[model samples]
Target chain A: MEDTNSTIYALKTSAGQERNVARLLARKARTIDGIGISSILVPESLKGYILVESSTKIDLRNPDLKVQHLRGVVEGSVGITFDEVKRFLKPEPIISSIQKGSIVELISGPFKGERAKVVRIDESREEVVLELIEAAVPIPVTVKADQIRIIQKEAD
Target chain B: MKACTVCKMISSKDHCPSCGNPTSDNWSGLLIITDPEESRVAKELNIEIPGEYCLRVR
Candidate 1:
């Protein structure tokens, strides 16, 4: 189980500068004590915001963290939970999570050792429509869900 | 089971099949990278490949 901290806060920063701010905070955290920074993240879909995990309430006004670069934190949005962040985390591949454009290597079947990309999925049938990536001509082939191993996901 | 010391990829073989590095059973973190392009965690870790990775391997 993950530790729970009530001091997690979200800070607004310059758009496209979350990475820089995170780096700065990490450096600053080494110098400070009592309030140590744990996790830091900048969601890809969101701009101008970064989540910070700390042991205690951070004095945003403190100059050590260089809060000048930070605009303001999201009030009432503190106490960020790991469960919340876990949702944004990359989900491991499962049978149902497989989708179109996912690259897979056949684990068992006539095309064993062959690599293919998912073109479609049949939920009721628990089968997938695959296109052989190495084939001279793109041809769609149907296979059972358990026949292939996921290489790259469609989301990637 | 063993973990690759190089890429932190978990594999049963003696060598890491991902990077061909030697494998060690001592490892932690079952990280899965589905999409590297839009994943901030992926960018932070400098991982470009979509596969299973570990946070730490020793």
Candidate 2:
């Protein structure tokens, strides 16, 4: 799925506003003629930037396409390759990086904000068995992988 | 926003307007196709409609 004709450019945007910027750019590209903006990508893992695919270089200073939260094109950028954008296109599962005995912080549910040690991982279910570090007794609590953030990796 | 399970098109409806598939709220990555005819990304993803889409839907 490589495209040699169109070049991928990174557009800087305000943090937490990548979706808004992409939406605005999409609307502008449709209304304004000859902007050459083909597609806009807002990857969850990639923050503070959005990818724009175009046949030619985009002029961000164009008054007609002034979109809020859109800063400008990345400096010294000569377009990104398809290989670079491939990871964003198909992101790996959140549990792929987690390991047993890793220290994690729960971000949601009844155990929200609690620190825990990963005891076991069920890849098929996408759930993790964790032992709360702050609890009095070592009780295993199962949680969805997405609800926990890895705080420290288990020492090799 | 919800994403169609079949087409991955992002919308607020329970079913996709284009493909008539059930929509899911568990989705990641945003892809907006402004011009599908000119977009190489759109072509690679095989998206014909010009609209917001999700790269991954669960």
Which residue pairs clash in candidate 2?
none
After superposition on all C-alphas, the RMSD of every candidate to the true structure, in Å, is 11.9, 1.9
Candidate 2 lDDT over residue span B1-58, tens digit each: 8999899999999999999999999888999998898787887788999999999887
lDDT of 1 by residue, A29-121 (tens): 655665456555555545788776666666777766664467777887346656666644443324587878999999987899999999999
lDDT of 2 by residue, A1-156 (tens): 443468889988999999998988888788878888889999998899999998777777778668999888886745587878878887899999999999999999998999999999999888999999999999999998989999999967
Candidate 2 chain B: worst-modelled 10 consecutive residues by lDDT: B37-46
lDDT of 2: 0.89
For candidate 2, what is the interface RMSD?
Answer: 1.6
* Model 2 spans with C-alpha error above 4 angstroms: A1-4
Which 10 consecutive positions of candidate 1 chain A have the poorest summed lDDT?
Answer: A86-95
In terms of TM-score, which candidate is strongest?
A: 2
Best by DockQ: 2
Real A-B contacts recovered, model 1: 0.00
Q: For every candidate, what share of the true interface contacts is present? A: 0.00, 0.84
